[model samples]
Target: MNNHFITLGNLGLCVAASLNAQRLFKDHRAPAAGIFLVVCSAALSVLPATISLDWSSQPAALCADLQWAAEVLSPAMVSFGFLWLSDDHFTAYTLLTGSALLSMLTGWLSRDGLSVMSRCMAMSSLSCSLTVCLFAGNPLGILGSVLLSAPALVGLSGTSPLVSPEAAGGLLKLGLIGAMTVGCWAIRWALEIYVQDLKGWDKSNNILT
Candidate 1:
C-alpha cells in the first residue's frame, strides 16, 4: 500500500510538471521555466532512490519513518545503477550505459556551458527523465518514467538554443511516440494482472465447491 501511494505521488508530480511546461510553452512563452519545473519534479520523483537513514542514530523513530517514506516515494536509482554495473546481463549494461550517457549530456549543459535557463533546464529535464526511466521497476513505473520525460524532451528540443530546430523537432516527435508506446504497454500489463486475478478467483471457487 505504501509503495503504491509513493508511486502515485511521484506520478502526480510528473503530471503536474508536464502540464505546467505545456502551459509555459504555449501560453506564457517561458518554456525554460516550465522545463525547470519538470526537472525539479523529476528530481522529487527520484528522491526516494537517494534517501539515507543516517538519522536513525538519533534514537527517534521519526527518522526511521522518514527513511521508510523516502524508500516508498522514490525509485532505487543507486541500487539499480549498482545492479547494472554488477550484473553480467546485457539488459542491465544497456540501461547503465544509457544512464551514463544522459548524465554526460546533462553535465555538458551545466550553467557554465549553456549559461541560459532554457538550455540548462532542457538538459536537466532530459537527464532526469532518462534516469527515472532507468530506475523504474514495473510497468506502471515505466509508464510514469517515460511519460514524464517525453514532454520534457519535446519542450527541451523546441526551446533550447543548443539544439537545431529541425533536429530537435524530430527528436521531440520521437519522444512523443515512445511515450505513447510505453503507455500502451502499461495498460496491457494492467489488463493481464486483472485477468490473472479473475482466474485465481475462479480456481478458488471450484475448489470450494
Candidate 2:
C-alpha cells in the first residue's frame, strides 16, 4: 500500500542521512558507531508515532504521516544541526531540513514541537539525498548517500552552518519548502478523496448493472 511507500521513503531517508553523516565523521576521524545508534533509534522509535491512530486513507495517510513526522522532529535537528553535518555552510543536510521543517509548519501551524522536529529531520535528509544525487557531479553526488555504507551507519556526530544572504532569506527558503511539502500532501489528500468517491460510485453502478 501507500503506507509501504511512505515507510520505505522514511527508512530510506534515515539510511541515507546515516550514511552521509557517517562518511563525514570518518573523513574527520570521529567516532561513528555510537552516534549512529542514537540517530537511527530516535528516528525509528519516534517517526511511527506521528501517524494518526485513525489514519484511514492511503495517500492521505502517507502524506500526513510524512508531514507530521517532520513537524514533530525538525526543531531539535535545527537546534543541534551544527553537531551533525559539522558546519555552520548549511551543508546539504541542514539545507534540506529547512524544507522538511517547512512541511511541518504548514500542517500543525505551531503545535507539538517534537512531532514537528521529527518531520523536519526525516524530510530534510530525504530531500538532501534526492537533491544531491540529482545535481552533484561526481563523488559529491554520492555524498548524499553515506548512511548506506555499514561503517557510516554507526557512531555519528556532526555540525554545519546556516546558509543564506540573511535570516529572512533562509526563512523564505524554509517557507517555500514547507509550502511545497504541504501542497504535495494537499494534492494527494484531495486525490485520495476523489478516488474514494469514485469507488463508491462504481460500486453503486455495479449493483445497478
Query: Highest TM-score among the candidates is held by which one?
Result: 1
Task: At residue 91, give the lDDT of candidate 1.
Answer: 45
Worst 10 residues of 1 by lDDT: 67-76
lDDT values of the candidates? 0.39, 0.37
Per-residue lDDT, model 2, residue 68, is: 35
At residue 43, give the lDDT of candidate 1.
Answer: 43
TM-score of 1: 0.26
Which stretches in model 2 have alpha-carbon errors above 4 Å? 26-42, 45-209
lDDT of 2: 0.37
- Candidate 2 per-residue lDDT over residues 15-68, each given as its tens digit: 543653455353222213323433453355235546555435664455444433
Query: Model 1: per-residue lDDT, tens digit, 1-209?
Result: 44444445445545554554444343223222323333354445345445654533452343332222222111123223223322324544443354345435644665334224333333443344344335433345345434534443334323334556565435444444345334323423432343355467789999999
Candidate 2 residue-pair clash tally: 53
Q: What's each prediction's clash count?
A: 1, 53
In lDDT terms, which candidate is top? Answer: 1
